[model samples]
Structure formats: structure tokens, C-alpha cells
Target: RHPGWPARLGPLLVPVGRVALRPPRLLDGGAWSHVRTRDRAHLERWEPTSTVDWADRNTVLAWPGQWGALRGMARRGQALPFVITVDDELAGQVTIGNIVRGALRSAWIGYWVAGDRVRGGVASVAVALATDHAFNVAGLHRLEATVRPENAPSLRVLQKLGFREEGLFRRYLDVDGAWRDHLCFAITTEDAPEGLVARLIGSGRAQRP
Candidate 1:
């Protein structure tokens, strides 16, 4: 049987310059919605086709429940859903999902930055933090991320964090309404010392928050 979910999760904080990562909150709905609404086109170009009806008011109202489910997942140690904040403003989100413990000890990572934050190193910082949390705090042996071959920005993020290219998966995921090929990238605990965050900061790719 799976572990029972807890009522709450302990605070998980990661700071980088004016950027910080924390669990999602209900109060973030408006800001989250705004970012998504504004960046829908920008995001869809590289993201999977989301079934969630972004234009529906009902869907907007369901933010709390959606966030609640993420918290539940975190409590059960199955996932970590975090929001990236820059100077107290919501910039993006990163999630480590499909966590498998036992022998595999791995998970898949995904993320998106608000259109305004793109190319500004927000995704890089967020990825670094997520990678650190996955290998250090979560105690996972490995973390993987898949990106479309044309997604230069995301590919750069993975490369900066030392995720090696594993191979291409043909029709790996349904993205932007089509089954698309993806380039797999992965990093294991043995890949870096002091975690990816320290490496990023030390390399001057990101500033310490």
C-alpha cells in the first residue's frame, strides 16, 4: 500500500538572489492564472496540450483544489510542486513528478516560466533548485527531464545543470496537440557534489539568494 497522505508539509525553502522556491499556495491563483493567460501561446508552443480549460471560469475557481492535490502528493512523498518567485513575484513553476523509490529512486522533472521571465535565467535558477532538492532533500538517486529538440532554452537549462543527453524518444509525449519526439536528459546524485544549486551559483550562472 502507498503511504497515507499527511495534512500538511513542512516548509521547503530555496533562495537564489531575488528568486525563491516554495510550495504552491491558494493565494497564488490570481497571479498564476494571469501568468498562464498571458503566456498561453508562448507556453503552448513548447508545452504539452493541457486538458485543463484555461478559459473556463470554473477552472479558475478550482485552483485551490488543484493546489491541494499537489500538497497531498508532496505529503505522500510522491511529488514536489513548487512555485518560483522573483522579488516576491510569481515567475514560474517546477515540479518533480512520477517519483519512484526503491531500487530506481528516480523522478521526472518539468517546468515553465512566465513569458516575461523567459531568457532571463529564471528557468535556469528554478531548475538548479529543483535538481538540488531532488538529489539532496528528496534523496532520489536520479532525476530526468525531457525536452523537445527545438526547445533550445530548456535544453540549455538541463545542460547548465550537467544533465547528460541520454537519447531521443520517438513520439515520446503528446505536446502541443501532437505526439512529439523528445530528447531525454538526466542527472544522478553522483553527477555533482554539493548539488546542482551550488554548482550553478559557483559557476556564476545564478546568484545566491
Candidate 2:
């Protein structure tokens, strides 16, 4: 584990309005499974194809192993995996992965909200909170995200949070099977001196559930 990992990055709850981000708990399996199954079709287009059936009973039963692996990564300071909550109910997830220290203090952010929760600023608030934590608490200098051109909603989320378009990566990731091109977006601590969540709220764009 990294120094002060527990004290600095241990289980945390960041809340704003009706939205919150917290570590995924093993006990959340049933709720998480329910939401994922409900949003499978809504999410599959943007996500990589999975061999494991989300609706399968065994998948939900595997929560302990999955959660344990993620927890291990968190302990090693390699990732921050959080479940998005609305009014204390599980809504989706936001993850900060590929953490690199040394001279390059950076990571990548990814998130998904329940289909019913889309376009309601739930993703924006969850992402903004994650970004703030990545920059301020995680001590990361830069955060990046990638989105398919057709993913207008995701692009809007990045735009609203002020992520600058860096460039395009041809066939960057395998989504739903085939390699897909993605536009890279990034933000740095210097880019938001006032902090992302604060700026978002001040812009009168922060919507509560």
C-alpha cells in the first residue's frame, strides 16, 4: 500500500445536492446488479463487450471477488472506484484508474449513470466530484477522458466540466467488439483554480435529483 493510503484515500463519501460518490461495498452487489441489468442495453453501446452476463445470478454472486480486487487496487493507490449514489440509492459508478505517480501525476476518469438518470446532471456532478478529489485529494495533476464522437451526452459532460479536447485516437478502445475512435479530453489542476465542482455549481448548471 502507498504511504498514508488509508488516511488519505480510504473509504470516502463526497456528496453534493442529491448526488454522492463513495467506495463500492460488497453488500451493494444486489443493488448494483439490479441497476446494471436495467442499464445494460443503455450502456453496452459505449462499453466494451463483456463475456460475463450481468443478469446471470452467478455474476451477482461474484461480487466479493470483484470488490476485493478493486479494494486491493485502491490500497495500492492504483485506482479509485466509486459508486454513484442519488439520495443514498445506488445510481451508477465513476472510476479513476491508471494512476501514475512520480513525475507524471495523472489518471483517467470514466463513469456511467443509470439510463433513467441520464441528462439530469447526475453524471456531471459525479464526475466533477471525482475530478476534484483526483486533483485536490489524490494529488494528481492531470485527468483525462475519452469519448466516442457520437456520444454527445458524454461529450457534453466533459465540455460542461471544461475538459479541453486534446486530439483523436484512431481505434483507441474496443467497444462492443470493434475498435472505436475516441476524442481525448483532459483537464489539469491549473485549468480550474477555483475547483471543478464549485465552478459547476456557480455556473447554475448543477442539477439535483
Could you tell me every candidate's TM-score relative to the true structure?
Answer: 0.87, 0.89
Query: So what's the TM-score on candidate 2?
Result: 0.89
> Per-residue lDDT for 6 in model 2?
36
Reference-based lDDT, residue 15, model 2:
39
Candidate 1 lDDT, 1-209, residue by residue in tens = 23322222212233433666788888988888888878777777777666865455224576788798888888778888888887778888888888899999999999988787677677777778777767766778998999999998899889988999999999999988899999999989888978776787678766643
Q: Write the per-residue lDDT of candidate 2 for residues 188-207, one digit (tens) a residue.
A: 99999898878776887663
Name the regions of candidate 2 deviating beyond 4 angstroms: 1-17, 207-209
Clashing pairs for model 2 are none
The TM-score, computed over Cα atoms with residue i paired to residue i, of candidate 1 is 0.87
Model 1 RMSD in angstroms: 3.8
What are the RMSD figures for all models against the true structure? Answer: 3.8, 3.5
Candidates in order have lDDT scores of 0.77, 0.80
